[model samples]
Target: MNAMTTLTYFFPRRVLRAVVVLLSCVCLAASAAESEAAEQPNIIFILADDLGYGDLSCYGQKNFKTPNLDRMAKEGMRFTQHYAGCTVCAPSRACLLSGQHTGHVHQRANGPIEFRPDPQDISIGRLLKNAGYHTAMIGKSGLACNSQNGNHPAEKGFDHFFGYISHGAAHRYYPQVLWRDGEKVQYPDNHGKEGKHYSTDMFVADAKEYIKEHKDGPFFLHLSLQAPHADLNVPAKWRDPFVGKFKEKPHTKDSHYRNETHPKATFAGMVTNLDDAVGQILDELKEQGIDENTIVMFASDNGPMSEGGWDRNFFNSGGPLKGGKRDMYEGGVRVPMIAWQPGKIAAGETSDHVSAFWDFVPTACEAAGIKPPADTDGLSYLPTLYGKGEQPEHDYLYWEFHERGGKQAVRQGDWKAVRLDFQTDPSRPLELYNLADDLAETKNVAAEHPEIVARMREIMRKAHVDTELFKIPAN
Candidate 1:
């Protein structure tokens, strides 16, 4: 006899009816759950390594045009005052993932440092995964120093992870081996100096595949592309287009990165290649019919680097900002940020919201209709995106870098203060600037504004909590 016949025969009519009703309710609840999961929006965060704020044409690049990114800006909202977590890679990513600023984040510097988060600390991947979303991190994940330990991407709540586990490994454009979840996948063709495969292209392919596989429901894909970072290498197809577009000056120096024949052309090509990859991911989302249900955010990890023979001044990579890369100035920390979601975020909108990378976690949580962690240092700018509700503002933003003799910066209203050599001398004098009047931060008005300087110094002192690994001397 069938299971249903057996059940009916073993029970009374009322009991059998109750059994049927219970089964029906269970099925209905499951169906409702599946529907809810499908209804939640997909999130794709694309991070470009070492891409400058003004690298894209939309952000005032006169050297090369980023048509796809420009199109993305026109179709979505562009943020003019978005800042990265820090001036470097590892710490910056740590702050972004942990939803905390550099002041209280683990892995404050790049090196052979262990990424040991607090027991209560929740990563962005974990935050989304707990909400019934499939999470995937494709491309460079510079947080972990050891992949086998608890610091691995898998352990950090990513359901699927593919790419370099360390920052040093990510410097190469043609990597010999890449991590697939917890396994190391080898590429024999890319074993030597020259290779048939490019790392960024592989990352894009994997990202596209992940989107296709998870097209039905809620998913969070962190697509981190290592491009325009170093080596100044790209296939002829991407580099050839900009070969003769600019004045020629070959880079033949032997440094950390390989020398380039035409540094400017190759750099421009790398950016354009990055732009193309973004376009492909967008196209894939549209083809899967999830464009309206997916929100794509594009931003660089930090500012541009002068490494790998790439010319920052030739391309004006930092735009009107004061310094590039390593510095604590606007050019180093401020980066280009774009958000695209059809029928959700308004089109052709530009917001001067002073948001930072740490805010991503809360903003994404709010977008997915979930609550962010209570200990998070970031505030969601969801209201600004939808042009509804009263958007919250930050009282101040803080950043501290361990490298380059230690740097600390604080931004409050129109005033900005920077302190150098803080690790050695915590009571160092701060260089103050009125950003409202001098956006470039060319002048130091610390002597003129003593009270403001005192207030900023107090903030810097209180914001930083000394850690065992990266400690700032007590004031």
Candidate 2:
């Protein structure tokens, strides 16, 4: 007390006041930081494999209803003109995680052989991990690389990862093995056709558990579900309801996919099962009281596929668009996309904002209050989600496919152009369509619109950066 009294007498009143003000400011700054962290919403991105634009009830599925997904759209923002990164799985996911388009992204195709990307390429998982979010990737990851090469989801910045690492391995619903982090977790019970553990069910259960464990988190979860894709597999409970719902069509031709007595019904049931999985995750979030602090987004990696005994025409899976998975048409790339966040994103909003998978990284970064890498070919759609601020628009969108003899497509405004077999015939004439008038792409108006076609041709050429891995031959 004697020393404190002597020091206080030596110190001037203005100096003592300045010290108090500085200490108060420090406390206020710390409190603001804590508040900001609490406000950073947890992000959950649910990617469906081969689920089409019209597969969901809200999106015009007549055979089966996706009440959960429909409700998600009702409570959030539904994107009418959203597109996937590519027409296939591997490249589409590559574009998504890398924040690059198919033109610029690594792993441009689901090749005969698996391809691995450069380890230096940044991923959305790494971006969020750096932003202090607990990251996990569950279900099928078709990213073309594994932990051995330092490209598995865990090595790519996800703190945890579970499910199938290979795209081909993910085709089977009842798997004998699944990946957990860097190790393979064997499922003895899921042996052959006598397995009770469906991969979809397991993924949903694990996702719920992950949410529960990270209830207080600003976590980032990529729950990639393998459903309504192929093999015509679904639990009896889901399949039985739609057993006789449609006229029976037995699919026995495809040796690659399992023989299904009721292919249509099974396909419908698989979609409904996927819908139920989404509902379960939403319920878990609500139960954990984190619904308001979470942003849940659902989208398919690509459009519908006629593989695995699943019929695209029967489901009208591509909606009013033409073509399917392999084609560069609207049906192949255009997909269903929805975003939900209570108290933040206003309900009952449908955004016709033309967006794509590449935009996700920037959007997520903005949501987390982190600056995205400057070189990304994506724009944040956060402003559109919040229903405020001036939303930026893209000049055009481009996609190139290596399979199906190589293809390229470009969409600028309402004008869409498709160039087939571009690798072998670089001088192939671009088939142009006015999407606003011909959404089905039945009419090729390229001859009538030579100027627009010429512009699209140039854009396509400029957009494609020649790569040894996925090459587009010169004219």
Candidate 3:
């Protein structure tokens, strides 16, 4: 051996050996951490209640500006052909979480009142939890009303939940008590009138806390904000700006809930407040150093509401789409959706890749490297998100409503077919609209295209399996 090598061999050989082993272990630990981080990404899905397709400035809302949402669109991918599950709340949320269409989803309508997802049901939360991720739902979880009755968010795979359980309770922004996990936590300050405590404020705080707590996380967060819905009430600070801007019509008071004298201003304020929440969530992700590895999504539950003195036509909330909530039109189902990831999803992109609430399940599964349940109607849009591979197209998309004389709609390629009053009269003539030609859905060309109408009718018939609660009446 050389003179230096012989000197090193004589100088603490056991100490040198231990030092080399320690270095190897340190490198291995770092490699394991990097691998875990790469395998799992944080997911944040923010669902706005009763927000219309054109409610955001980015989506063409001219009356009020939504700067944050517009910025989000500029920083992310905006979806022009994205749709909500249904025209209502509970069913729409169910479709989103369960990854099932209205036909197959458990909650078909707003009521069989106090509807909750079955314990054994396959939900996005459960799927993610099974894949070893922390899951939480904050804000208006209209899925289950009474936690004591047992169909709580906890049962549906959320480790933590804080929000209004009942759909009706959600209508009132300030409530006496809200559900926290499995218990009802009282907010005595929030009485009948506008109190110091605001549900939206609470939700935002909770969401931020959750993110901070799970920063070193593979976490799934569903931030369901009850904004711009009905009972058009907002905090004075948010509502003050829009007051007296638009031509006024005082909203007549209702017994069920408080009414706003300046409904127009209040509505705009509520939406802007929601926009602020979105901005805050994005900021939190960035601050937590997880923005690059997190996929942030924003979407509405359904179309704008016509109730609580809110005017859909005045604001052009549906944009060029025909009809509002409850109608089987583009306005009711089609809503703005934005997906943001710094490097993963291409920035300043727009995707017309037709997708809906059900599609989210497979998309989330693909992102998390988890296998989605076999029975899901959803197909993953991860390819579109990643902007890499070929994205598979859906044969058709379908939706059915139990209320409003019963309505069903199907979209096959560029053609849309609607069967209105289906339960009342199963033989009613179908309305066919070539969405490619008429985005407004003004003209019905059933007489011009009999063959397409027939195919649409058949698809509607097969799309839905007979459910006792949402059944086609026997004539």
Candidates sorted by TM-score, descending order?
1, 2, 3
Q: Between candidates 1 and 3, name the one with more favorable lDDT.
A: 1
What 10-residue stretch in candidate 3 is worst by lDDT?
Answer: 142-151
RMSD (Å) per prediction:
2.6, 2.6, 4.6
Candidate order, lDDT descending: 1, 2, 3
Q: Mind giving the per-residue lDDT tens digits that candidate 3 earns over 369-461?
A: 878888899999989999878899999999999987899999999999998887778788999999999999989999999999989988887
Q: What is the lDDT of residue 327 in candidate 1?
A: 90
Query: What are the per-residue Cα lDDT tens digits for candidate 2 across 311-354?
Result: 79997999988988988999999999999998889998998999
**Which pairs clash in model 3?**
none
Q: Tens digit of lDDT per residue, candidate 1, span 156-262? A: 78999999887777888889988898888889999434698899889999999999999986999999998888878988899999888888878886666777888
> Each candidate: how many clashes?
0, 0, 0
Query: What clash pairs does model 1 have?
Result: none
Score candidate 3 by TM-score against the native: 0.91
lDDT of 1 at 123: 89
Q: lDDT value for candidate 3?
A: 0.87
TM-score-superior candidate, 1 or 3: 1
Instruction: Report the Cα lDDT for residue 168, model 3.
Output: 74
lDDT of 3 at 274: 93
